[model samples]
Target: MKKYLLIFLSLGVFLNACKKSDDDLTPDKGLTPDSEEVMVQDFMWKAMNFWYYWQADVPNLSDTKFPDTVEGVEAYTAFLASESDPGVFFDDQLLFSEDRFSFYSDDYKELTQAFAGISKSNGLEYGLVKFSDSDDVFGYVRYIIPNSDASTKDIARGELFTGVDGQTLNVSNYIDLLFGDNDTYTLNMADIADNQVTPNDKEVTLTKMEGLVENPVFLSETFEIGGEKIGYLVYNGFTNEFDEELNNVFGDFKSSGVTNLILDLRYNPGGSVNSARLLASMIYGTHTDELFLRQRWNSKIQSELSDSQLTDYFADKTNDGSDINTLNLSKVYIIATNASASASELVLNGLAPYVDVVHIGETTRGKNEFSLTMVDDFEGSYVYNPERENQINPDNQWAIQPLVGRNENADGFSDYTTGLVPDIMLEEDLENLGSWGDLNEPLLARAIQEITGVTGKRGFEVKMPLLEMTNSKMFTILKDNMVLDKKLDINIQ
Candidate 1:
């Protein structure tokens, strides 16, 4: 029932039924789409055709593909019959080939819960990295969610895991081995020596909970370093459910007269775009008149919108009419990595024109587009409407989080497709992954050095910098997505 549905940091849609017959261009495992599936398929195609950002580029989504005549209705029906699975119909037929962020789910309820920061998670947040130049992969625990199975176990942050259930992890079998049906698994522990991984002969077992809700505002504290009040926050997601709590943290920082802030977004995948704006407003001044972000939709959607509807100015209040806690800082220090994406990247991109964001760590996931949560409503646009939930088709509960538009700043710079490059490039030292909030941690320490002009224990240089193959966050229900909390009512019909 929660309104936050951008819980996924990122996900990949896999539908493999090679170039087939003319009508059955992309079937799934030779299965034909039934009548019910065909109905659901109709919604998928219509939703993409009406709202997709790259709708103009995908020829299959052309308006003329199925005309408005009696014969065209029959042709549209035939077109929907080709794909067996609704997901495949969405991925293989409707989506642009370059689209990596658009995704769909069979149950909107399950997906919405995840966006609320609640999911079935073991709570061991980690990143998978290849062993320098080998097929073998290893994982390092980034952080542990409190009240989770991993929190109950002896496993903690910086712990290296080489295998699951005693089998060594490789690129091919890792996905199935970790994310497969088994709810419980033992992580084979290992340690790095001279930059090489060696099994430590220890293991930690963890189990997934049914409804684990993660509070995105992980750690917030204040410290006085070099005579300046420094506020450090480890934010994991931009979940709207925690918007008030997040604002309160900034309120605390403001009351404490914090002059400098270190925003740790190393693992945040992203969430609601509205929450992103609120978080940005919290860091920067709440200048309601100034342009905060600009939206660019498909040509059809663009044509109907006035400039006021597309442009988002920095807000002075939260969506619920609460005054936003303002920092009004001229500069901010951000810590990120390859895992940082969506709303996480939005904070960096949206604030660039105003604030001086000193980015630390590796390149980000580089996702600039924003998505909308669409469900199978009576209308073909499939836009999610809570008031019309009962009107959704009984046979199909399918929902899509499609990239409907891209957000740019006041200066019109939103080309972070490759990723936001770091000004102070630093990677987490696996052998010495420091505890959270530690000023001596490699990434934070660098930021501290920049702020305080004094350094401490900066000896650890990243021997073989780890490039994340994919992390545990990337496989979650949300997969990196920046969702627009407000809905668009463009009349496509």
Candidate 2:
């Protein structure tokens, strides 16, 4: 089956800097757009224009047209003015609210094109595609790209995308074309049903494994290659609670006989910056304080890590007789992929200075921006509701919040916006995911080769559908045997 995962853009402080106050008695009108308010308003207008053009169902626009400077603005303005039948006027007082919703015709087109690419890439069977406008609080249209012919289209679908003006775009379709379609089918799942491949009989064929044990605490699962010790562990998400869980996971690894580690952050989409610091503390040892994740705000120089609550995170560096400064590993292999993003990239890039790092996978999604804390003025109570919001409130008067105080990396580096590239880059055979586990694909194969000095057979490239339809027999099994296992204890009363 083909899965359609949605691509999301996080709101940076810069994103929310445009909360204009109509209530202001003295509003400065500058011809040469200078202040943050202008940028924000311009951003919203441009975003609207993007929707207008996309919905025209015309050809895909060039990426170069993205507004970058004052000159670009003149060009866009001229384009709009040149249109004889300007459907939407340049000076049209367009107000974006949470109530109305629509989709950029082009966004849907892009989604269609992406789906076609994914279908061809994964060799999946296409089903009927449907699109509809969303009735969500935030304005957006939902598009459902199904994998099978029978899947139903529900208004209640998936994620929402909001423009800079707080106008949200609902998924007209339930499938996030990037992940998998609801009704798509993959050759592997099809083959498994047809009895083409059998399970790996629990035969532990993987033998040789080597890597530095930076976070000595992650040795919970023992690999046979190390001759009987839980040397390495791999987890997906770094949730808010992961801070404490990570310490325990790492601490347990050290005492359990894990001398090395290989952190596999292939599909981690990122969560919890504090958890990221907590992860850093394990390998950073004592000097973890020095490694900065970066500063937010326009005047980054004014920010410092000590100013935030995430400070002294590794405050108790002394664990048993071993401190962060004293703990050392031989080598660290960070397994990555095109999907490894945000917090995942943070760990990979943050620990680069002190470790012998090896990255294996496609280029990572570049993202840098922590959620800001927002204090909204509740009506006229003079009470600012303090809450940690993803971006700044539309109202400029509200305060911006951040977890990391500093504006740089732990290595004293700056400008960490585009994300980091790995030292040893390895492309995975995309087609192989059908026959093997997600991490057991070519990327991992290459990482293992680099770490263990083994030159195994090259992996075959096979494209599988992003999503597939498993019958109720399989679906019931998944819900009962898989999803539930992670939560409730089945044996409990």
Candidate 1 per-residue C-alpha lDDT over 215-240 given as tens digits, one digit per residue, 9 for 90 to 100: 99999999998898999999999899
Which candidate leads in TM-score?
A: 1
Give the per-residue lDDT digits (tens) of candidate 2, residues 1-493: 2221111111212122335465321112212234443433333233332222121222212335535668765654554444332223322322222101121121222222221112122211122111123332121111222332212322211112222122222244223321233233211111122212222212111111111011212223535342423234455445543345566666766666565566767545455454565566675454544643544332222321124422223333432233432224546767665555566766666666666667766566554443322122212111112232323235433221212222245565634445567776654321234222233446555555565665676653433221212111111101101000001111111
TM-score of each: 0.90, 0.45
Q: Assess each prediction's global lDDT (C-alpha) against the native.
A: 0.82, 0.36
The alpha-carbon deviation from the true structure for residue 324 of candidate 2, after best TM-score superposition, in angstroms, is 8.3
Where model 2 places Cα greater than 4 Å from the true spot, the runs are 1-220, 226-230, 294-296, 300-327, 373-375, 378-407, 434-441, 457-493
What's the C-alpha lDDT at position 473 in model 1? 83
Residue 451 miss distance in model 1 (angstroms):
0.6
Instruction: Supply the global lDDT for candidate 2.
Output: 0.36
